[model samples]
Target: MSKLFTPYVIRGLEIKNRIWVSPMCQYSSQEGMPTDWHFVHLGSRAVGGAGLVMVEASAVSPEGRISPDDSGIWTDAQATAFQRITGFIRAQGAVAAIQLAHAGRKASTAVPWKGGATLSTREGGWIPWAPSAIPFTDGDPLPHEMSLDDTRTVIRQFEEAAQRSLAAGFQVIEIHMAHGYLLHEFLSPLSNRRQDEYGGSFENRIRLPLQVARAVRELWPEELPLFVRISASDWKAGGWDVEQSVLLARELSAIGVDLIDCSSGGLVADAKITAGPAYQVPFADKIRREAGIATAAVGIITEPHQAEEILQSQKADAIFMAREFLRDPYWPMHAASALHAEIGWPKQYERARR
Candidate 1:
């Protein structure tokens, strides 16, 4: 039997297979509400046979979004809108998941296809928040240094969003602590240089993210598994690295995080990332072994045998694909065929199944 096609159980959640769909931002929301675009986009993956279909980095509040068009779970209406999408995913025999995120200094930016520049207030942008009063890039607007009240508010926002995610029928909640977002800004010294309880030293730096995790954990159902995605390395000198990621994973696991989705290098613009196939797999492998926690390997993982090798060697419990899934939502179904594994295809598409 192909290990990649085997069921993997986490807590009370049993995924049908080891291939999970990574959260990819569509930048297609209006007033934080996902439209038909999101429903069809996410629904297709579930129909395509992924074990889990995760929504993109959804902001916990208006100011937390990466762009004005980013998704959010801050309102009851938004949560209600997600019900149909999540229901569709579950109906397709795939677990529906959502990533709760705050962009921090990276907020108030234009979407990638539209130049991806930091937007000014004149352009319908608001001041971004961060652990320190620093900009992601030198010329970008400086973010507001988060006050103690701001920290508490964000933690509360995560708890509230978790409740909303539950109401929306999402079975999994992945905390977005990666991609140089708010939580990540606090973890990396390169971005967080404040002299407070939530910054400076490593313990202090990790304080906020851990608090958010604990708060969300308290609100979420005990049966559902919680995941946290982290950029294992900042890819720059004197920044957040794998060692810190291992410690972070251990701490998160202690507080009920079921899996660490390991991806690397989104902390800076010119951090000299050495990108290649499975370049980030070692981070997942090391963290899983050292922290005694489950990990999901991501980053340029596109082939069946490569994914099979990662799972079979105990490098990672599962593999998450973003671009490949975008290229072909039926990747898991195709992968089963490529690996010669007898996995089920959607009954509606059985005639097309070879």
Candidate 2:
């Protein structure tokens, strides 16, 4: 039997397999609402046989969006719009998940194809928020340093977003604490330069992220799992590293977080990162071992045997594939064949299963 094709249980949810689709931003929403593109983009992956299909980094609030086109769940209408997508994923035997995020200093940017440059308020963009008034890029405008009230509002946003996710029919909620986003800014000393209780020292830096997790867990159903995606390493000296991630994982687990989705870098523009196939698997292995928690390994994890090795070796509890899933939405189906694992294909595609 293929370890990658095995069912994994967490809380009361049993994912059909270990192959999960990573949250990849589509940059195709209209005023934070998912359009037909989202339905098709996500629906195809469900049909493709992933055990879990996570929607991209959706903003908890409008200002939390990475770009004007990013998805949002700040309103009931948005939550209602997601019901169809989630229903389809469930019918296809795949769990539907959503990643709630705040872009922080990275907000107010144009889409990638539009050069991804920062936009000013006059140009239809709002000022971005961050732990410190620092710009992500040298020439970019400084972001608004979040005040105490701002922190409280953010916590409320995450809490409300979690409720919306549940109402939207999602079975899992993955908090986006990675990729240099708002929560990540507070965790990394490189970006969080505040002198208050939310900055400086390890405990203070983690205060807000912890609070958000606690608030979300309080309301999220106890039976459903909550996952957190973190940049296990900033890939720069004197920045957030694996040791700190292990500590954070422990705290999250205590607060009822079920899984740590491990990915590295994205804290700085110039951090020297050595990227390769399964380059990030070690981080997941270390966190799972040291933190005594479940972890999902991501980052350039392509191919069937490669994913099987990670799970068989107990390096990670699950696998999250991004670009590879985009390239081949039916990757899990193909991988099952490669591993000689007997799995059901969608009845609609049964003829092609042979």
Candidate 3:
């Protein structure tokens, strides 16, 4: 039997397969509410046979958005808007998941298609917040240094968002601690240069992320699993790396985190990275072995045999594909064919399955 097509369980949740749709931002929302575009974009993947179809990185608060158009779960109206999308995913036999995120120093930018530059207050951008007053790049506006109260507020925001996610019919929630976002900004010394307890030491730097995790886990039902996405390496010396990631994973696991969605290098713009197929699988393998927890491998992973090999060799517990899924929403169905696994196709598409 192909491990990639095998049923995987965590807590009380049994995902249909090891193939999962990773969160990919559409940068398409109005006032933090999802539209018909989101419904079709996410629902197509569920119908296409992914085990778990995750919504994009949804900001927990307005100020946490990477772009003005980013999705949010800060209000009841927004959560209600997500019900139809989640319901469709579940009905299609795919687990519905969402990533709760706070962009921090990276907040308030034009959408990627529109050049992705920083927007000023006149242009509808707010002052971004971070561990320190540093800007992501030299020419960018300096982010407001988050005060102690601001840190507490962020933890509360995550807790509240988890509540909203459950209300919205989501079965899984992945904390967005990866990329160059808020939590990651605190993890990397290159971005977080504060002298407070949230910075200056490994234990101190991880304080807030852990606090958010603990807060969410405490409020989130024990029957459900919690996942965290982390940048295993910043790809620069003196930045967050696999070692710190292993340690962080252990801490998160102790606090009831069920899996680590391992990815790498987004803390800074110029960090030297050598990317290729399965370049990030090593990070997952190392963290899984060292941290003694489940992990999801992501980044440039394409093809059926390659994904199966990663699982068969125990490199990662599951596969999280982003861009590849965009290319073929029915990737899992095609992969099952390649592996000679007799998985069922949706009834409506049965004629094409042969």
lDDT tens readout by residue for model 3, 1-354: 899999999999999999999999999999999999999989998888899999999999999999999999999999999999999999998899999999999999999999999999899999999999999989998999999999999999999999999999999999999999999999889988989899999999999999999999998899898999999999999899999999999999999999999999888999999999989999999999999999999999999999999999999999999999999988888899999998878898889867
Global Cα RMSD, each model: 0.7, 0.6, 0.6
Point to the candidate with the largest lDDT.
Answer: 2
**Model 1: colliding residue pairs:** none
User: On residues 260-309, what C-alpha lDDT tens digit does candidate 2 reach at each position?
Assistant: 99998888999999999999999999999999999999999999999999
Off by over 4 Å in 3: none
The count of backbone overlaps in candidate 3 is: 0
In candidate 2, position 77 carries an lDDT of: 97
Error of 3 at 94 (Å): 0.7
State the lDDT of candidate 1 residue by residue for 1-354, as single tens digits. Answer: 799999999989899999999999999999999999999999999999999999999999999999999999999999999999999999999999999999999999899999999999999999999999988899888899999999999999999999999999999999999999999999999999989898888999999999999999988899999999999999999999999999999999999999999998888988999899999999999999999999999999999999999999999999999999999998998899999999888888899976
Local distance difference test values of all predictions, in order: 0.95, 0.97, 0.95
- Model 3, CA-based lDDT: 0.95
